[model samples]
Target: MKSSPQLPPGTCDCHTHVFLDEAKFPLWAARRYTPPPASIEALTALHDRLGVERVVIVQPSVYGSDNAATLHALRTLGQGRARGVAVIDDHTSDAELAAMADAGIRGVRVNLEVDGERDAQKATQWLRRTVERVAPLGWHVQLYASLSLLGACADMLGSLPVPLVFDHYAGAQAQLGLQQEGLAEVLKLVESGCAYVKLSAPYRCASPDALQSQEPLTRLLIDRNPDRMLWGSDWPHPQPGARPNASDVCPPFEVDLGKTLNALASWAPDAATLRKILVDNPRRLYGFDA
Candidate 1:
């Protein structure tokens, strides 16, 4: 096995999650799949092996808007080493938001793809509402949707007061490279500093043979603006399994995150840029100390 890269000090895995103790923190009834016990210990071990020092534990869709499990993990890891992105709704209280902010929650997640939502109108509405709520708190809205949906809502992006974050390389079409449908809009956001992208979870999106395109995709992103790029282990690497309301619990993908970081090493043009993705960019975005 190839060893993981020795990342710079203060390197942060910009995205990851922890799901454990189901009796205390049950999965959402409407979730598409049941994830295994991705507890904080497992996450810490994975990051330690990968040479990552900090993490952003994003609230998985299975947890819905509860934010409890994610917040618990963030609190366990503590604000200094961990930050979070929660899932909230209109009914979420300002008190709760303040508590989350204190717990180091820097953003909110809108994972429409997990909901199998394709309508851009609904997505646009979601975007508007979520962004408006989080804007005053200086938090960004992190999104996961089809590229088509992104393009449909791209026009309104500039008016938002806070930065937007698109995870998983903004839904790369591996065979399509920069020509991926709707990529132009997302790339423009990255270039103009209106948005950020997380280089995570390629195994969830592309076939192995087509993984070559990630290099060019990363190159284009860097050429546009390296400062907006981030890298993540996406630890335990959850994949959608049998639909929710089913009896099956899907085990997480056995991704060697060391390899994932190595892939990132190749994507970046040099040592300086890789440090930006693994360290500086996350510090700026997640409000981590320098």
Candidate 2:
């Protein structure tokens, strides 16, 4: 139980999820892979142990637009201690959106990568439309898209009605290194303060020497704009995943979260920068009380 690399006070794990009772919050038929029960109780204990004071429960792609599970987690955690980012379809009503806002949801997620959708044009369209939909709620749009898709549409970032939140390094390809096309654009977006990037799931984009390779990647964002950065455990980190029709389950990745925080400290320019990433930024982005 080494939660060594101490987390700062008011530190928020900005990107995490909890998959509770499937009977009540069933998975979508079109989902890629089944996830094991990663409940709020487990999440709370883990956060408590790690010294993280606040959390943001992001809607996992497996649930599609059904946010019951995410909302449940937020309620169980209680306000001031937790907030959420939900997933919604065109069918979701304004009343429902308003209800979610009241329940402490601060954002909506647009996950293009999970659907295996490679159409950069379509991805950009979805993002723009999602921004329009959630804009009225004053919620930022969180995107989980590939760097290639992202690279093709960086020009569109400046014109969005709402702020953008990039998940998992904005789909940067660790192996691609300098060849990661959207990397520069993402850096610029952070620099311009039009978007926020989560320094999360480094293992997802890891190269052979993952630790060494991930350093520069995380550092680049920290260096460009620490104010716009967020750090998340991406807890219960699921494997890459299988087809929509696949019957098998995707087990989570094993990570030493405390050590990962330490690594983030190394990437950030200073202690205050780390605090900005872990505390100040998430509070402002999610509307947590001071």
Candidate 3:
């Protein structure tokens, strides 16, 4: 087996998901795809093997707005080692939000991909309301949307009251390289100090050859703002239609975790910059204590 990369102390995998006992935390009936249960025990083992000391458990789309699984995972992985980003709507009560804040939820996720195309007016309204709700708590908004939608919402995104985190390379389309529509807007956000982006799931956005094409874009983003960058494994990659059966517990899907880590490492100008991306940046954004 290829050896895991040696990461700095307090290195954080800023993005991951844990799907525990299905009977206890069932998938949303309207979910676009079903994922195999990736229990907290399995995630911990992966982290230990990868030499990752901290993590951020993001609420996956399959669970919709029900953050029970994400909350349970965070409590189980306590000791200030794990934080969470929940999926919530305008109806979510202030009491529930306060409770989640105490439980280590530091942000709210707005995933536009789940329902596909949406009316621009309604989407903007939802974004505004959600941001207003989370801003006072000093929480950020983690956005998972398509490039087109990102472009459409760029102005509002830049104006939000809290920090913005764009997921999966800002949903850039691989085939277009740096010329991808909406990418410039995202880069501008980073340049203006209005946003952060996750260097993760390259496979989701780029093909093997296209992955090489991403080098320039990756380097540019790192150079533009290393402090605004974060890394994640996107573990157990849940592809569309990948449903898990309750009868069998299969081996986890195969992904070259080491390779992903190395690719992100290559973009760093030096050891210090790498530490900033893997450790310092996450600490600041996720509010991890020194």
Output the number of the lDDT-best candidate. Answer: 2
Candidate 2 — which pairs collide? Answer: none
Q: What 10-residue stretch in candidate 1 is worst by lDDT? A: 204-213
Q: List the residue pairs that clash in candidate 3.
A: none
Evaluated against the true structure, the overall lDDT of model 2 is 0.85
Candidate 3: worst-modelled 10 consecutive residues by lDDT: 241-250
lDDT of each: 0.84, 0.85, 0.83
Q: Give a tens-digit lDDT track for model 3, residues 152-229.
A: 788888898899998888888667767777888888899888999998877768763345666777787898888899
* lDDT tens readout by residue for model 2, 191-267: 99998998898888884236557887888778888899998889888774633444567777778787787788877
- The TM-scores of all predictions, comma-separated, are 0.95, 0.95, 0.93
Q: What TM-score does model 1 achieve against the real structure?
A: 0.95
**TM-score (C-alpha) between model 2 and the true structure:** 0.95
Clashing pairs in 1: none
